[model samples]
Target chain A: MEGIYHDADLKDSPVSEKKTVVDSPDIAQTSDFSNLPINLQLDSEEKIRLYSQMVRIRRFEERSLRAYQQGHIGGFLHLYIGQEAVAVGSVSVMSEDDHVITAYRDHGHALAVGMDMDECMAELFGKRTGCSKGKGGSMHFFAPDKNFWGGHGIVGGQTPLGLGIAYALKHRKKKGACMCFMGDGATNQGPFYESLNLASLWGLPVVYIIENNGYSMGTAESRHSAGEPLARRGEAFDINWSVHQGHDLYEVRDAINNALVLAKESSSPSVLEIVTYRYRGHSVADPDQTYRSKEEIEEYKQNKDPINLFRDKLISEGVLSDEKANLLDQAAKDEAEASAEFAIASPFPEVSELMDDVYWETDNPDQKVSSGEMFFESSR
Target chain B: MPEITYREALNQALSEEISRDPNVVLMGEEVAQFKGSYKVSEGLLEKFGPDKIIDTPISEAAFSGLAVGAAMMGMRPVVEFMFWSFCYVAFDQIFNNAASIRYMSGGLINVPIVFRGPANGGTNVGATHSHTPENFAANTPGLKVICPSTPADAKGMMKAAIRDNDPVCVMENTILYNLKGEVPEEEDFIIPLGKARTVCQGNDLSIIAHGRSVMVALQVAETLQEKHGVSVEVLDLRSIRPLDLDAILDTVRKTNRVLLVEENKPFCGVDSQIAYLIQEHAFDHLDAPVKRVSAIDVPQAYSKALENFQIPNHDRVLAKAMELL
Candidate 1:
């Protein structure tokens, strides 16, 4: 009876203050790179590099969209058109030991981690020369050698995996962290909460980055989520939580850098919500007009485009000129076009190679350890 | 060779593997401090330390997925599910991430993780906790499923599962944990996956079974020999995914009359697949249609009497074998 709850003791009130905005207004207002924190500050050359990387992602996504329209590319293309800074900026702050894994919208992360444009495009074309050898199209890209774990297709599924990577690092006594990126909608998933509890309880070096791009597919965040500031859910698990605007590459770099430092130094996990916008529909197959309006899409494009914002910032700081900017943009466009050509020229995977990568034992015949029939169907 | 319980044999395998490889870690609910729910991981936490033998929160999805991530990074993690029925909560991680990560990455990544726990019904734990998922696990192409019926096979197959490069699901039985059998003490001793063991040789009929049902089939074999004067062969399928088709075909060719047995349900059960393979490959060799003795096709009941009739037992299997004779 002592442990039992009664209606008389229950009081109905709001869980927390309804603070909708997670982004820091101060960081958004700061324009001068010199005034930024020393850890957050970037050199002129590095700034230009980040700008160039964002441009490259935008152009590559645009090209892939074109291919999808032309019927050359099949399946869903979750283009990272508007949220380039989230990938480029976060990846730039990572040490060589650090790793990354993300949800379906993963092309931007793949390119940011230095995956070749040709292979990425070929993968979109479902060619053998692709990153996953045409086995994993659009949604799945992997470069383990580069510490980029995968382009996992399932929503909120990669959260525990990211935690595991960090768990492994700690288990092996390695100094690094894993940044697990997911959409705003992924917060509602059961595994994400479970991951949060474990990450905080074990003090694992993992940063769960929620890219709050205002919409979860067609549903707005206000409709899909109940409480304000999704990252605050980390507080329940005793994890450090914060939010910042993703449009500013500097802010994105700073917030992510701080979280990464907490992971490496303290072996603690943090949840940082990066408030951003996506111009394209959830996938190309999704018609943008269903849940959102044209004016909302145009508004984000004009005011908060990550690529244009960074390019203009670089130009304003005298780190890049108008002519140099145009040249870089043209170069990105050319590179994307050449990647499409490479994908076109690349051959599809041979039918013989269909079962090649299914198992390690099957791949290496001499070291083949398991007995009996591995595959149900025979290629011969 | 020392005779040991199925639980002790599994413990030996985990201990030997943990001592051999630094990357191997034992993690699950109550696995460390509690020494596992079934005491299969007894003395592991003390021998291997907290880092190697970890106790996780009752979050199967997180821990299962965490093991997968660690395996991707070259760490061999052996995760125990308190009960294999609990694995349904982490189905996405076990089925999608663990099973397909290797192939999806074009073989760039290998999930060298092992999920081991008892997956048996008839304890009257009700329908929720009583689920034999070996069939479901084997259905996935990227996964390897093994059901060890004896202490020796359990030890050898568990060691094999830990060392395997792909995700392996070891389906153990709670009732079989206390069963004693001779187990090899050698640290390097391992039975390769996907190989069938001929428990007994006969001329009349073959009773093909795996896991707990294999024990039932063996009992039926004994009764058939002494009571009915019928020669019954018992074949134990240790691994389900890389199924021993050659051994299956050979036994069917020898005995001529085949009777498949399993603890799984009749529909899409491991026996169903075996029955299909027999009819497909050795249909003409069969004296009669390959009959199956599987768990009754319904949700497992909680009542002792009904549950007894539900799971395949010695009497049910003996009756089926007599029909084949």
Candidate 2:
């Protein structure tokens, strides 16, 4: 390519060219996460939110996977299974004022951030009442009222946007931060590096959480990634870097809350890579067995499952009862069913609605870009 | 009205808008400290301070995407690309994020940002620097693609683009930056996008153009009227995305002959759409087939002669108009 479109020159060089801040040589389990700076144990209300949100995301994905099998979701259905603990954990530390953006596997992110389940289900069904009004299907869900930016389809595309939102927060002197979620696969993209560099240079209050789910689609991290661990790449930009155990909810929550504390106190960016794995394929179409062995998947599900680990920890610690937890899970499944019903009952969007909302309704009637301008009738 | 360079007109608009709203910001390579790669942002950094006028590290994708995020959060950011050709690096962010955010969010959110930069071919800046991507922006839905010809239109459109509730890509041409013209001195002056400006009136042929080519249309129209006694009506399409086809149809209906001109390649260029729309809506009004003069299909060459041959000049416009007549 003649222009900046070609990346041929960047082929030889891998992701990073600098060193990370390990402080200590050991990169092991290290310490008891229960003794974090911030209180990791959920309060009564926070406990309900944390537990219900995780269960809600789980049941929603299961129902959506079934819906996809039934030919309801026409396009790529990236189920967010095995990532519920990460979303729930990170979102738990976030306040309503904080802005959130993530990559395509965002069903969990939506539910975790309190998006209306009915709207989300309707969006998957491509109904008018969907969160995106049928303009964006499964891959794109946005709830500005809840401070959720979107489910960006382009990989690593939300990183810069997240950084920009953080810049806006810093500009306005607002006491809020932005959380950008991306997959390990997105680590290879150019914008990711650019965003990290600028976020650190400008000291923007944003935390980048890499849901490093072992694979960037079918390829393993060893094949695609140059570095052993993804979090260490942040050192190139002098960004604070750490790895969080995604399979455990307590660790994920504590780690994210710790990251946010550093972000707020310093007004700088930090990279937190959650070492997780997705149980499902990249999309609904993939068999998922092509890259990884069946035994590995079964082992992760049986032993290192995020929900199971959280449930066991809660049960053993007596923070929650198994029966009460079962009730919560059942309630979530029932809510998912009700929302699915609501989506089916909802009507398809009007054909005319396709033209509306393309541009905002302007104050000046004559100046409206799409309202009464061009081929359409200017109704303003 | 006072005559000023097209560059100063744009500068005045930015200074005015920055003063009008605190949320409005400027960010790009050398835009602040160096006063812009072109002098369009001269004295902006000093007047507005570093907080308002920011300089980036040539990270087009990240900075433009950042602007998109800022705009969504109720801040108006005006991002300047050194050249519009560099916009390709941020294509996903500009088209996917900036343009689609509002519609995809069900009107709940929007990005009120403007990506302004030179998108012309006559600068001899080589194939890499001299891309006319107005058609690219115009092709994408949810983006307001504005290209102005004169200082007045340049100043006016910049103001309107800053106020637009959508992502507006202001495709300025380096060739016209220093070109001086009579600009309105009114503080509240602004020319809304999608409205075409009449350069000169004629009865024989309508030469409709945009960007630097609009000057060619005006010169050709003036030459035809004085030398050959052929009166040509010239129309400057200030904005292309929300194209003012009504103005084009009105001109076609009056003159009964049309000659569309542009610096972009003939294949899928802005004029191609205009020519198609002309025949589609004003088919009966035409006395002859509507002709178009566009840049030759090639990666723009660096040599002066090659660059000149690539862009449509007044002679080419005149010849095309005569053929249409």
Choose the strongest candidate by DockQ. Answer: 1
Listed in order, the DockQ scores are 0.79, 0.55
> Which portions of model 2 show Cα errors greater than 4 Å?
A1-31, A362-380
lDDT at B172, model 2: 95
Q: What TM-score does each of the candidates earn?
A: 0.95, 0.94
The residue-level lDDT of candidate 2 at A25 comes to 35
* Model 2 agreement with the true structure over A167-244: per-residue lDDT tens digits: 999999987899999999999999999999999999999999999989999999999999768989999999999987
| Residue pairs whose backbone atoms clash in candidate 2 | A372-A378
Candidate 1 lDDT over residue span A1-380, tens digit each: 12121101111122133122224354346555435684336788888888889888888888888888888899999988889999998999999989999999999999999998999999999999999999989989999999999988888999999999999999999999999999999999999999999999999999999999988898899999988899999999999999888888888888899999999999999999999988888998889888988887776665577776666666657887767777777898799989999999999999988898877878888997889988887321
Residue B107, candidate 1: alpha-carbon lDDT: 85
- Using alpha carbons, what is the TM-score of model 2? 0.94
Q: Which candidate is the best by lDDT?
A: 1
